[model samples]
Target: MNLTIDEIQDFKGKYPKQIWSLFFSEMWERFCFYGMRGMLVFFMISQLNFHEKEANLQYGATQAFVYAFTFVGGLFADKILGFRKSLFWGGLLMIVGSLILATNPHDFFFLGIAFTVVGTGFFKPNISSMVGQLYKPNDSRADAGFSLFYAGINLGALLGGYLCIAIGKGEIFSSIISESMRWNVAFGLAAFVMVISLINFVFTQRSLGTIGLQPGHPESELQSAPMPKWKEYGVYILSLIFIPIIMKMVSVPEYTDYFMLTVGPLTLIYLFYEMSKVTAAERKKLWAALVFILFSILFWGIYEQSGGSLSIFAAKNLNKDLLGLDPNGVNNSGGAFFIIFLAPLLGLLWIWMSKRKIEPNTIIKFGLGFIFLGLGYYVLFATRLFADLQGITSLNFFTIALLVITLGELCLSPIGLSIMTKLSTKNLQGMMMGMWFLASAYGQYVAGIIGASLVSTNENASNYDALITYTEGYKQLAIYAIIAGVVLILISPLVKKLMQGVK
Candidate 1:
C-alpha cells in the first residue's frame, strides 16, 4: 500500500493541500455533531424532565451507538460502496436527523438520535480512512496530518459548543423568540453545518484522486459486471432495520451494556480471524495495535466524561461567568481553543522530531497520554480539598484541569489515528478504523455507567454533597489512569518490538 515514489516526493509542505478541504468538511460535521452533544444532557434534564442518572444512561446509550455503528459502516464501505459514497449517504442521514430533532424537540428526540447514530456510523470512520489514504505507506507526515484533522474537529466543537450555549441560554434567539424556542435554534444550526459539509465535499472530492475507488473481484467471470442492485439495497434495508433496535437500546442502560458485551467479543473474534490470515510479522503489528486499542478504552472512558458528568459539574458548581457567556459554553470552548493553538505546533514538532529521529514511539506517546489524563483527574480531585476548606469550586482549578486533559488528548487521539493506518493491512483499513472507534464506543458506555453512579438523587443536596461525589469520581478515575499509564510504559519495549519498524 506504500505510495509510489512520485506520490512520496509530492510532500513539499507541512500538509497536502487537500487536507484543508477535509479539514473544513470535518470541522462543520463536528460543528453539527458537538453542537448537539454539548447540549444533550442539559436538554434532557431541563426540557425532558429526565433525572440525572437517566440522562447519563441515555447519553451513554446514544454515544455508544454513534460509535459502535462505525464498524458496520466500515464494512459497507470496504465491501460494497466505497468511502466517498458512504460519506455522502451518511451526511444526508445526519442532516435529516438533525432537522428532525429541531422540528419536533419534544416528540422525536430519541428518533432523531437514532438517525444520527446510523448516519455517523457510516460517516465518521470513512472520513478518517480517507485522511489516511491521502498519504503513502510509512509517510512521515501522516501523524501530523491526523493532528491537523483532529484540531479541525475541535475547532468545530468550540464553535458548536458556543452556539449551543448561546441559543440554549437565549443569548442569540432571545430578541424574537421565547426561551422555550431557543433550543430549536441550536439544533437547526447543527443541521445547517452538516449541509455545508456535504456541499463542500461534493465539490472538492475529486482531489482525492483514485484513493477510495471500489475494486472488482479478480475472477475473470465476474470482473466486468457491477455489484447487483438488490444486494446493495438489501444492505441499506438491513441498516435501516437497526435504527429502532438502537433507539430501544439507548432508552435502557442494561440493554446498552448488553449490546456492548455482545459486540466487544465479536469484534475481537474478527480481529483474531484477520490475524490468523496475516504473516507473523504483520500479526505482531496487529497485536500491538490491539494493545493500544485495549488501553484506549480506559483512556476514553475517563476522557469522555466531559460530555456527561463533567459538563453537569461545570453547569452546577463551577463559576460560569466568562464575560457574561454561559459557563458550560466557555468550558466547552476551552479545549477546542487549546487544540487550535497547540495542534499545529505539535504537528510541526512531530515533523521536526521525525526528521531528527527523536520522536517518541507510539507506545510511549500512548503512555504520555495516560499520564496526562491521570494528572488532569488528579488536578480536579484536588479541587475537592479546596471545596472542603474554602467552599469554592475554583474556576481556575477547573480550567487548569481541562488544559491538562487537552494535553493528554493531543498525545493519544491523533496518534491512535496515525498508528491504526500504519499497522493495518490495506484491505482491512476501513474495518480497523471502525474497530478503533469501537473502543471509544466501549469507553463511552463505561463512562455512562460511571457517570450514572455519581448522580445525586437528593434534589436539595448541598455543595458539599456534590463536591464529595465529584471528588470521589475524579480520585478513582485518576488512579486508574495512572495505573494504565504505568503498565503501558512498562510494556513499551515489547510493544515497540511488536511494531516492527513502524514509528
Candidate 2:
C-alpha cells in the first residue's frame, strides 16, 4: 500500500510536526560534525605537527570519503535497511567516532576519521532524503522547508563552532581543564550532542509515520530487489577493505589526485546507468541536475577553502585576534552567522517570490550563486594590491571576503538540496542526493589540491610570498566562476526546458 504523497504531506501548518524532530536531530548531528570540522586542520597543524600542505591533503581526503560514502550509504538505505535504520546506525557510528576522538585524538586520529567518514556516509544522505520524503513532489513549501532545514544545520554549526573554540581557546573552562586537554574536551562535547540527537530522534520518529520506513515499506519499492545476504555482506566487506587504501591516499597527495581522476568518470557512468532506467522526462531532469552538479563542483571547490588554505591564510597572515576571540574560531563562524541572520529572510523571500510566480528558476539561481562566488574571491584578490611591505592587510578585508562567500553559499546550498530532491525520481532520490554530495566531494578534493599549491615549504617563507600565492589563486578562481556563471545564465532557458516543468 503506497501512501499518497499528499498523505505524507498531510499536516495543518506550513510544516509537519515530524519536521521539528528531524530538524533537531540534524541540528545536534551537525553540531558535532561542524564542531569537529571547525577545528580539524588546526588540530592537525598544532597537535599532530602536520605541515599546511599535509593537513590540507588529509582534510581533503577525509572529506572526500565522508561524502563519497554517502552514495553507498544511500543505496543501502533505499534497498536493505531503510532510511530510519540507516540513520540510527550512522548516528551511532558517528558517536563512537567522536568518543574515540575524545579518548585520544592523536593516537586514534586515523581510526576516528575512518569511523566518522563511514558514519557520515550512512547518516547524511538518508537524513536528507527523509526530509524530502516529508513533502509531496514539487511542493511549493519545499524550498522554504529546505531553507529552514539549512538554517537548522547552520544553527548547530554556530553553536559547535563557538563551543569548540571556546573549549579550545577561551578561559571559561580553563580553570577546570588544562589547555593541553581542551581539544579532547571539545570532541567530547560533540559526542555528547550526538547522543542527544540520537535519543531525540529515537523518541520522536514516530511522528514521521511511514516516511522513511524501509525494507518492506512502499518507498523501498523504488529500488531493485535487495541483494542476497551474502552479496550484501560482501559489499560491506569490500568497502571495509578500502579503509586502508584511503589511509594511504591521505598520506600521499598524489594518490588523492589519482583517486579523483578515477571517481570522476565513474560517477558519470553511474549517472548514465541510472538515467537509462528512467523515462525521457526524468532523464532530462537528471541532465539538468547534472549541469547544476557540475557548476556546484566549481562553487564548492573554492568555498570549502574556509577550512583549508583560507584557514592558513587567516592564521598566518591576518591578525591574531578577532573581536577578542581566536581568529580561526571567528573565521569559522562566518557561515553560521550569515545563515542565522539571512536564512530566514531568504526563506521568506523565496516563498514571497513563488507566490507572485516570479521566483528565479533553479538554473538561474545556480548562476547567481556562481556570480557571488566570483565576487567573493575577487574581493580577496583586490585586497592583495593593498598589502603593505610585510604583506599584512586589514582584517576587515578577510572578513568581507568570507561574508561575500557566505552569500554565495546561501544561494547555492539550500537550493541545491531542494532541487536535487525535486528533480530526481522518487526511487532514485537517495542516490541523487548522494550524487550531490559526490560533487561536493570533488569540490573538496580540488580545494585541497589548490590549497596544496599555495603551501611554501620554506618554513621561513615570507608573508609576501604567501599573499601573492593566495591572491593569485583567488584571481584565477574568480575569473573561472564568473565566466561559468555567465555561461550558465545563457543556457538557463534550455536547462529549464530540460527540467520538464519541474519548479
Q: Evaluated with lDDT, which candidate comes out highest?
A: 1
Compose the digit string of candidate 2's lDDT tens values, residues 1-503.
34544666876666666677798999998898788877778888978899889889878877777777888788877766778878888888788889999999889887777777888888899888888888887788888888888887788888887678667664357899987798789988998999999999898665666667766654543445544667556645665665566556656767767878898898789889989999998999999999888889888888888888877876776764346555676677777878878877888898899999999988888888889899999998887876787877656667787788788788889899989999999878888988999889888888887788778767787898888888888889899989988998899999999999888
| Runs off by more than 4 Å, candidate 2 | 1-5, 169-172, 218-245, 320-322, 383-392, 457-459
The sequence of per-residue lDDT tens digits that candidate 1 reaches over residues 271-309 is: 899899999999998998999899999998899888888
Q: Cα deviation of 400 in candidate 1 (Å)?
A: 1.4
Best by TM-score: 1
Instruction: Provide the lDDT at 342 for model 2.
Output: 83
Error of 2 at 210 (Å): 1.0
TM accuracy, model 1:
0.94
The number of clashing residue pairs in each candidate reads 0, 0
All candidates' TM-scores?
0.94, 0.92
